[model samples]
Target chain A: MTKYNLPVGPQHPALKEPASFWFKVEGEVIVDVDIRLGYNHRGIEKACESRNYIQCLYLLERICGICSHAHTTAFAQGVEEILGLEIPARAKYIRVIIAELERIHSHLLWLGVAGHEIGFDTLFMYAWRDRETVLDILELISGNRVNYAMNTIGGVRRDIDQAKREQILGMLDPLAERVKFYTDLVTSEPTCLARLENVAPVPADKAVALGTVGPTARASGIKVDVRRDDPYAAYAEIPFEVITSERGDLLGRAIVRLGEIGESVKIIKYALQNLPEGPLTVKAPRKVAAGEAVSRVEAPRGEDIHYVRADGSDHPERVKVRAPTLANLFAVGESMKGAYVADIPIVIASIDPCFSCTDRMIELVQSRTGTSSVMTWEELREYGIRWYGHGHRS
Target chain B: MCGQEQQRSDLARRDILAELCARFPGEVGEAAAPRPGRAWATVSREVLRPVTEFLLGCGPGAYLSTITAVDTGEEFQAIYHFWVAGTELNLRVRLDRREPAVPSIMDLHPGANFYEREIHDLMGIEVTGRGKLERLAVPDDWPEGHYPLRKDWPGLPGGESA
Candidate 1:
């Protein structure tokens, strides 16, 4: 039998974002996996250099549609540190509210993707259908499903009015019950257990050595969570436990994420009850003083760090963002080495790979000829033309 | 009581800084309190590897949170930020702008791989000894030699609008 390579994407049905996965397969197992990113790289970091602190909030939010609030919150905190401004307690609670809401939505979306990858269409549909509840809650407060644009330099842009607050609370009890039900179904259900349990096991040592963060590391027994280790936002005040499991397999990751949703619900409820009263935002200086700050937040996927350096100008001297998925992606690649190809999607899905948030680059070379092929911008147009039929030259 | 604990923590931070300076001698950069809870140290790029290795070895639990690179136009600065339970130690390494490459710490800290790639991709600073120096965030077709974060580089057209 001859060996062949298949490039899964730069565009593919399996992925929701633009990323290419080259799988070197011998029969049914992946021999080697090469990832190519930079497909969706819009030069965002570069774009941040020219934008002022206020404008960069919106820019950072656009970094990842699913994790927009986390990115913006981290970015806002970084700027706040530079100016040495402490957000009002009420604003901190609001930030926590939105951050947890974003986590709920992101985790639910991942559950749907994991279900879809395992050939469980029914579970996938149910997961996404229920995920809308979180999205609706977010929209009620922020007025947008994807980019909330709620975060500002000093605090947040919008406050949760009484009506919206009650609406959010109204949905919580039932949503919590549904989440628990799904949690049990995923963990105890025979079919899911068969597919996920004991598959793609990453040892605790390997996970730590690889610098895996978030649930991926937690699943492997590393007991490290940025929220707990280095508390930020309102996490220090709110009480919730960091979930961990020693199994370090597909099921372990799933269990940890599902368990986290329950914790997020608890945190949101606590934050709402303790919500403080004050203006939603403070007046921030248009020009920030020269300084540097490093802010770290625990995104649903893992630790999201942003380093901001300001030079007393509208624009930041430097803005460097480190998304959690970047660390987890390599660990996922390492875990996939010995797994059966049938389990590849489930394993990859387990890490909840978000190339949009995780910066990576990929290059495509033909396996048969071992030659690199360039897809010129003009060729991309032609390819689109051939696929979409050149739209009938009128 | 919490206030007293905070004061004790601050004193401990100073002691830690003093110990680092005495141990490493001239290698340790000036000790300055950046903020209430943070401390900073600048080291030559030559000693970055040793300093980071020493810090990580101090505790079984030390972790490198992230690595950030700033382009000073004439020189490039790479900052390795590490944190234990409550304290943060920032190591700044300055590299010549013309060469703009640092010996890779991926060998010491595999977690540094992605951070190094991000620095490589955005700041155009090469991290030698890394397995892959590929771009992590920028698009594939973005013009080569065009780094957006550099001070002198012209950013995207219609800059503020973007």
Candidate 2:
């Protein structure tokens, strides 16, 4: 058998996002894969340093068109923590509704992408059609469809009123039924089931070792969800379940994500029903006191972490973003091992890799994040031994 | 914060921090107060790999969320964000700006491979152990010396004129 290389996409039918992948193939088996990202990198992280806090909010929203709200939420949360400003409860509920709805849209969009990859255009069409309903609900609440500028430094920019809440609830029942139908279709339909089952098997232990996150990790039965583990916004108050599967393959990922849409729907419903009453935004000062904060949110793809460091300036001293897609990129390379060349698209799509978010650099030009005075390893070692040995006396 | 949920988050942070301090004696550095279920500690560049291993050893599989780097004028600070049992624990390592080099933790957390490469490309930090570090997210024709994310170099990007 001849060993050869096959290259797929900076642009391809299989990849909706811009990223290049080279797979080393021995006959049909994928021996190794090399991924090159940043075809669409616009240098957003460096840009964040120059922009004011409010402007940076809009800039962060543009990081990923699909998971815009997730990015913005992560960014705002970090800055707000540094400022020590707490948002009103009503704003928290609104943030949850919008974030979960964004999750629904993102997952549905991914399902459609997966379907399209396997020549299952019907599933693609069905998923996208239902996805429009989410977009419509987003518009009804936030006055925009894709980049809903819902989150701000102190709180959400827009509030969901009673009529809008009713409209959103009315939309979910039909959406839920459609989601259920799709779930059944993916599992029961012979062709759909065959394309996904065991295409790229990632055992639970291996998935954990690779540091995989989001539906990809959940599919392998890792049982990790940021929203549940570290409750932000209204996730602690509202109730929802984390979806996982033991299948550890493409099929498991599909099932987990499809199930997540259901969970997201329930979270949105609960949030609206128990909607708190208060102002959306408080008057946050223009300048953030000098400090550092890390904000993590479970994006549709996985856990999204944003770190912001303020130096008592109107513009942020440093802004760092770690998109979920970056966490799963290497894991994708690992999962591709021993997989057939034909399975490349779906296997990569299984992680739902969003390059538009991942490739953006969080590069900040300030040293010693908090302050410059850090002790050498020897000093810290002696300090730790002394403190612990003294038992409560530092 | 609910009593039970907050307790669980705090306990997780404390357990991981305790484990690190217990194993290394004086190496874990300073830890900040818990903020919104996330907290961080600073570590010298030398103990980065070991500290990462300890965090990963925390029960139920510690996940490395992502790696971020910042240039603090004279030194480049590499921050690794880890999520274990629901809370985010960050490790910050400062490297000399002139000869910016740090050991790659890809051996412990494979997910850091690409991130290290990305940091290498944009921040110009040398990830010695990760073999064949290639340019990621930067143009192929991009100059050899210019690192886009660093403070001084004003190469291709976010500016007044397009």
For model 1, the docking class works out as acceptable
Off by over 4 Å in 2: A12-17, A354-394, B1-14, B156-161
Q: Write the per-residue lDDT of candidate 2 for residues B1-162, one digit (tens) a residue.
A: 355364345335445655666888877678764754566778887888888877887878687877788876777888888887555778787788888888988888777777888888889989877788887778677768878789887765546336
Alpha-carbon TM-score of each model against the true structure: 0.86, 0.88
Instruction: Please name the candidate that would achieve the greatest lDDT relative to the true structure.
Output: 2
Displacement of the residue B110 alpha carbon in candidate 1, Å: 1.6
Per-residue lDDT value at A137 in model 2: 96
- DockQ for candidate 1, C-alpha atoms: 0.40
Chain A TM-score relative to the true structure, per candidate? 0.87, 0.88
lDDT tens readout by residue for model 2, A306-346: 88988898988788887777777778778888977556667
Worst 10 residues of 2 chain A by lDDT: A356-365
Which candidate leads the pack in TM-score?
A: 2
- The per-prediction i-RMS, to one decimal, reads 4.9, 3.3
Give the C-alpha miss distance for residue A244 in model 1, angstroms. Answer: 0.8
